[model samples]
Target chain A: MIGFNTVEKLKGIVVVVGNYGSGKTEVSINLAVNRKRAGIDVRIADLDLVNPYFRTREARKPLAKLGIEVVMPAEKYLKADLPILSPVVAGLIRRPSQLTLIDAGGNDVGATVLASLADAFRKTSVQMLQVVNPYRPFTETIEGCLKMRDEIEKTSKMTIIGIIGNANMIDETAIEDIYKGYDFVKALSDESRLPLKFITAPATLLAEIDTGRFSCPVLPIERQLVPPWIKAAGLKK
Target chain B: MGKILMKGNEAIGEAAIRAGCLNYFAYPITPQSEVAEYLSRRMPEVGGVFLQGESEVAVGYMLFGAAGCGARVFTTSSSPGISLMSEAISYISAAELPAVFVNIVRGGPGLGGILPSQADYFQATKGGGHGDYRLLVLAPAGVQEAVDMVMMAFPLAEKYRNPVMILGDGLIGQMMEPVEFSDRFKSEPSNKDDWATNGMATRNRKERNLVKSLFLDAELLEEHNLVLKAKYDRMKQEEVRYEPYNIETDYRALIVSYGTMSRVCKTAIDNMKAEGVEVAMIRPQTLFPFPIKAIRAAAAKDGCQVVISVELSMGQMVEDVDRSVQGKCPVHWHGKAGGEIPTPEEVVDVVKSFIK
Candidate 1:
């Protein structure tokens, strides 16, 4: 039943990586919050430098208020395109506590940066999750998702222990979409030989969804990291 | 149709496809790469062609080759990539081929930065490549406008037999907004049988059609120049488009802006109006056949004391503003280049200084 309780299984040094636009940031944020609410000491590192938009660091204020420490590069280099990995990311891996979540940059090019810190995870228990969103072009099919998983593992020098299904179209997602997405990810999990840790749905739609339909746990996503325009009107929290 | 939220880059791609443009070729560039990434999947579903060219230079000619065959085609790139495509753009322009190119402008003279900047105004409008030619540049201020302009670019290009550009910025390319596409615009491309290079055998015609910009003789070259100039002049007369804001009564200042920068200015104007300050604006939708007449008219308003050019660059478009004002009133500029966007509050503070 560990698959039905995904966040409960989140132990030391959890890293999330995925193709671009795969909603890894959203999963990272929700996972951190979920662990913290469960009375676990949580620290998340924003290792996303490939995308200037949609990053986990944008939720620093709210996460900090919830007693979750968000580690990131110095303030000046926050928006720079170059990858500036803080020493704290490796330091956390070496002496990880209850839960240390790393929100990695998107794509193989981004996962290449994770290779430098692979040694820290050698001595610790690590679970690298490849967030799969079938809505995105790169992970639309079973073959595409497998290709991405192979590429991420090769570049990061780490193996993906599980898969997270995060499929949604902003404001257009429906109850049927969540089920369809879950089925797609279930097929992906079967073919890729990875456990389905959990699947995500928007918090608004969580009440109507029949969780029995999915074999894995369902995590409710709070919409965050929106564009300047959407943030003006859509802060679901 | 109901509206759906979409990123500016992807929306432009969808709009281009909706406009009956079935061929897309481009190399990936930051801030605008989503356009290519989205089309790479959507194109095949629509039975269209989507290609990632070896380089931006190759992408340009691929667009030319496809456009020469009378295929509705387009490419999207950032500022530095646009510079690489300038030569082909000039060739496409002089050859009078109908193609659509979107430049999600970023800061630059040379790889300046990847953030949004309107530094390519002169290059897009006057001519980036060698030759006396102009691209019909269209600027969109938001995601919905970007979608509309891209859908409009195809027909306008074919109508004039010239290359059309949708000039945007990083902000416009990266942001998201709700948009609804009309079923009306989604149809087959118009006939290009006469000038298209579909092959002499296919057309079953005796005469051979040439698609080239070369003219060896001086006299013939002059004639070609004259013909091209005459077309541009007609465009100026027929295709000048702009939007005027808050010009009903005389105002203290007139802000001339375009594209994403104009949206920031609009926000600033609204904030200032709440504080009892009256400011008018003239947003030019077309940059090449600039709405000089509209800017002049706005500046000529009785109580309009200063004409301010708000832009993302240090002041590229201000020159046009100054020229349009023609020494009638004082002209000024406020901008930030190198990927630093001015906030609405910062813009309002500048407006306060101008009023004082």
Candidate 2:
């Protein structure tokens, strides 16, 4: 197993933004759970207003059970697609927990919401990381990845300091996909000059992988933003 | 290209392109606006036409115009948008034009919610429009199947020279899964020179092609209706498709389901088998030329006592199930329409209640 000490570097205000369907909500939930398991104070804001389904708020019960704070719109407006950023989001930004994670929506349109809270983010030591799933459409190549980064940065008015590789085919993920994903993000980090924060492998596949092959930490993804059917079957890893 | 993880909406757009469809017209609606978003950028790169009409009403006519010229055209919309387009759908069907329409169904009667629902079954399978016409409806359960269905829908539409509908739900549009675009389903566009309104000189024909739904003479209109009925009858014979699961186990209760809701029932059946309970399922891939014969045979199995139509709607498909069973055994409807999908545990309990 890989050491999780490197994840300790993810402190203060960290925002997860990426292209559509790049698994930002899953990564955000896992990061919050990982930090909480490490005995750190964590508060996550579900800022994904673009997507109608599969937002971080769907995992509120399990996350709350883990003693991690999950923030989002009020109950009345929970399922609404309206972009309602609660007052508590600014509070989370101003008075940062040990780990303050913002799971932004997908693409430039999604990240545009972050610009509204730019003033609150200015006061904090904020670091944004773009989650890259190489198997997805636009992020299949380094050039596409760079273009997305530019669009997101321009919209959010935030500087992305690192890259997080989250390559998988959902249930079809294999070891080769992980290694290839690691190599792709490694090349991306080299070309873009952004630090390689970490790459993720499904928790089920972690035991089969060698952590020494990569330079950055390996974040074991325990999928949380699944359909209700998968949830009822207890299929979560 | 190798397998790539794609949202169902985006995959539907790409699948149409790969299947030689270059014309797309749409109006944005959740949980399916992503299809328009993906194709808006993609169509330009592929030298295809992507137009966002002023409304779904206008978009329906856009498809009619393009499809009348024998162009392979399609549109994606949610429940309410489809309601607005049903008028055009009747016109297109009357003129016998080939077109594809995809409904990523959301909870609705009137903008009910943006969550997944299967309530549109009646609209898609029966006539949503004002006429005696039926769409060749294909329902896909997962993202990969969505891609395959979208690709196949084009050819299926052209083959029958009528509108074909791909019936999916919000989950099928929003969920991400790995898909590979294979050339297995690709085919050369069918020759439309005989009926297409592509101008006489273009095809070197002396007669101008006319496309219209209005048949003024009563006898001619009756003849046209009979012709349409023949085509529909042919479809009933050749196009029915379904998948039977766990039938070899001599299941006592048979479940009829489709789309995303069927996947939940599948999980329940698998789990129930381990607990020494035998439950079977029949998942319909085509809703219009529904697999009634197969369903009837499955329901008539020796030990089968009850047949249940499990769906995401209140009881839409159950009507078809009841008709298919024809009193072979008591048929029951078990589902929800409030956008809250019945979980596998709930499905197990629902089926268990009938068995005892």
Candidate whose DockQ is highest: 2
Across B279-351, the per-residue lDDT of candidate 2 in tens digits comes to: 9999999999999999999999999989999998889999999999999999999999888889999999999
State the local distance difference test value for candidate 2. Answer: 0.91
lDDT of 1 by residue, B1-356 (tens): 55555678989998998898889999998889889988987899889999999998999999999988878999999988988999999999888889999999888888777788899999899888889998899999988899999988998898888999999988888766667787665554465665588887777557776899999999999999998999899989999999998888557999998887787788888878898888999999999899999999889878888899988888889999999999988899999897777777887788778774
Native contact fraction per model: 0.07, 0.74
CA deviation > 4 Å runs, candidate 1: A1-11, A26-40, A57-80, A83-88, A107-119, A126-237, B1-5, B44-47, B179-191, B204-206, B246-251
DockQ for model 2 equals 0.81
Candidate 1 scores an fnat of: 0.07
lDDT of 2 by residue, A89-160 (tens): 988899989899999999999999899999999887899999999999889999999999999999999999
Off-target runs (Cα >4 Å) in candidate 2 are A232-237, B183-188, B204-206
lDDT of 1 by residue, A72-148 (tens): 99888766677789998889889887989999987787798799897887888889999987766557779989999
Candidate 2's chain A scores what TM-score? 0.96
